[model samples]
Target: MLAALALGVKDLVGSTGFSGEMLLGLIAAGYAGTDFIEGFMEKVPLPGAGAGAVAGPGSTGSGVAVLPDQSGNGAAAKVAAQMEANLASQLNAQTSQLQADIASLKSTAAAGSPETSWALLTGPSAASLTPDLVARLFVPATPRANIRTHLPNVLAGLRSCDLIDRDMLLMALATIRAETEGFVPIDEFVSPYNTDQVAFDKYEPGTSTAVKLGNIEPGDGARFKGRGFIQLTGRDNYTRIGSQIGVDLVGNPTLANDSILAGRILAQFLANNEDPIRIALADGNLKVARRLVNGGSHGFDRFKDAYDKGLRLIPEGVEI
Candidate 1:
């Protein structure tokens, strides 16, 4: 059917009276009609207005003439135009309402009468999440002193994954506190762990033999070799993660230590491992990540339990 139509168009264009430009216009109109014939009538509109207006090629005709049903044809175009205008008006009204709501929320947040925290966390309706709880969370943990040294990189890692959204990002940070009490391999917190060399050595290994036995290399080596966040341990895991993220984890383990790089890798791991996480979350796999990292009695719900505890410690208004 289309072939014959195309041949007819070709003949029409090849004819003497038809100019090149007219032929082009006819072909375009035919093409558009073809689309309309393929159950695309919804896009065709009523007759003459707005998006429905179909001028024959370059012709400036009002389209009422070109329409087969001229008398009622203009009505469809007018209707389509009115419908478009109505939709635009509704959208504008909705947008204004949403903006007003957002402004009101911002004002409420800025009021900072200690109730803001309560509203943000416990919902405006909840009774719990008292002011004291909020204070406990946001009052700062004596600065942890080491928080600045190690947390930024960890945050960078989370940000890289685009998982730095409020809920999960805070969850990850609180999980960090549960994991090592902010004792990153960085300078500030490195002192104590460094003192306990033997214990550290037992856990952090330098060689492939150490990795096989599930031991990590301590200090910068262990940290950069994949410690925090997703805990990208072992050469095998490194290779696998590297392949997955398009990063050379095997060649440059140091990238893991560089918060930004590490955060991205961790984010990739979490997002890509959604199915496993969903299953773990369903099965109450608190220690699902732990199992992935260390493979022990740790089950799912490990992170959830820690998060609950951390939430208790957190103050209102201050996000996790």
Candidate 2:
């Protein structure tokens, strides 16, 4: 399949070398065709849709084509309603996931400490996890001067989880500031990576198998592209992490978008493994984040700084 797609693409590129407007149209048409072939077409109503029978075209717009309600035959309007409800629920679930990811990112940025703050924030996100005592203690005060925009929610999440004490939280924040220049995205601090290390955060492996047959660049061939918060990269790491987490991490690369899930996976690896720690402690601690995110620890000494920084991010008097 990949081979076919690649060949088709190559031929398409070679045959036309089409420029500007025509190429744009072709790309758009191809995408639309792909969408139609997928299940997307099933859910989409024709333009200018309404509840019932198709009305004559008017200046306003075209009316939707409505099939007769199958309810009289046994499939009731209730069935359709139920399906609508189900779709709504699924959409809500997806929305919640998106919100959670956004909230997690915002909280992590605000809270400062990656480990304690994130653990604290996410644990209490669910109603079931909230403790009565902690809920009472949670003040509705405005966010402190040091905290960023989402500080309240982050603290709320922490309180809900009962993960850390106030003193510890402060310590975590300070640590975070020190490590990341205040929870900024890594890209702002680091340059584009030079090494072809394992793809971490958003790695997308190729779906079609035939990608390698013609003019195929292996790096561009869609195998184990890195992605996500910790940017878990490399084929070997993906395989191992997938096995450990009981998830098809490589198979379903999009799992990285699930922020809590991503964090859980990272915690499992970093908190559980010694090798990662050792790698982080090498290289005179020069390369910290790179080592952990890229697993440079496994084969090289490029992560000592990451370990030290992580430790420093821990608040005073709190032991790792």
Candidate 3:
């Protein structure tokens, strides 16, 4: 079916007027949201995207005429134009066919196709991610120096969540660093937000975001406020994430801040359903990743900066 679909799309492309220009834009844009398409798409190229145009018989790679313009006639220029036209036509045909094949593949796998298939990988060792490095990217306060102790947990979470990709790890680390204000691994605390104690007090029950997260109890705001490295928030979130990671975040909200569990929870959120964060990381779209994590771009610049620093520390192929 996929093969036939590609052939059919190719036929339509030949009959229709999809230009090379459109093909280039479509291919680039498609890379943003889809997977399994890039590998096949790599085989296709736009006129300029591919190597220089190759002239037909008796023409060189430069597409220069083998028969020189001995008479200073513009024969060479005409030959070059012909070569360009040929290359453009060739590239367009290939690109159109590949695009069709991609569409067919997407359709065939629609039932099981993931929003994005982030690469499954094994990243650097837990030892590789050091406390000093964490301090630099996230550097905790004098009292919070034990952040590195959770390295084992972070590694374990990566294995459980299968977020071994360097890019995915870096993205997760960056966000975790920012969300916890340098891996504090505790609940949010802001006296101003609540006349009482701690962070997330501003989120009373009935508030849209809180209500959406099912924080319906009288003290739900304080009880379920953002915790964990990624700052898991609200009663609904606590219950949901708790079930997945095998913890009792809903009952013992403080556990979300446990150095070890916090790391696991962060990884869990990244690899969870549709794995939007993983998808964003795969596309190198940190901005979108931030939006997915925070529902907005709050502190996104800080997140991106930390992620960049983490990238420098964690090199490629550092296994286990």
List the lowest-lDDT window of 10 residues for candidate 2: 182-191
Against the hidden reference, what TM-scores do the models get? 0.39, 0.30, 0.54
Model 2 C-alpha lDDT per residue in residues 130-247, reported as the tens digit of each score: 2221221222241233234323333443343343443323322322233332222122122234223443212223423223212133443234444433444455556677777678
Task: Sort by lDDT, best first.
Answer: 3, 1, 2
- Cα error, candidate 1, residue 240 (Å): 2.5
The candidate, 1 or 2, that scores higher on TM-score is 1
Q: How many backbone clashes does candidate 3 have?
A: 4
In terms of lDDT, the poorest run of 10 residues in model 3 is 113-122
lDDT of each: 0.47, 0.39, 0.63
Best by lDDT: 3
Candidate 2 lDDT: 0.39
What ranges in model 2 sit over 4 Å off?
A: 1-223, 275-320
User: Model 3 over residues 1-320: C-alpha lDDT tens digits?
Assistant: 33334324453244446434234334543553244355334434444532244344354432233445545777656655676677567566656765665664444333231111111011234326556545556632523455556666776777788778677667666776667665557767665633344356557775676667788877788788778778888888889889998988888999998877887888888777337776777788888888887777877878987786666555676553
| Candidate 1, 1-320: lDDT as tens digits | 33224335444333356443334434444454454454233333344443335454333233322232245667646655665676566556655554444444344334433333334434544433333332223223424555545556655665566664444544454444444443343211333422245423433566444566344434434433435445555556666777876888767765655556655655666666555655664565557744543444322244444455444344344422
How high a TM-score does candidate 2 get? 0.30
* RMSD for each of the candidates: 22.5, 24.9, 16.6
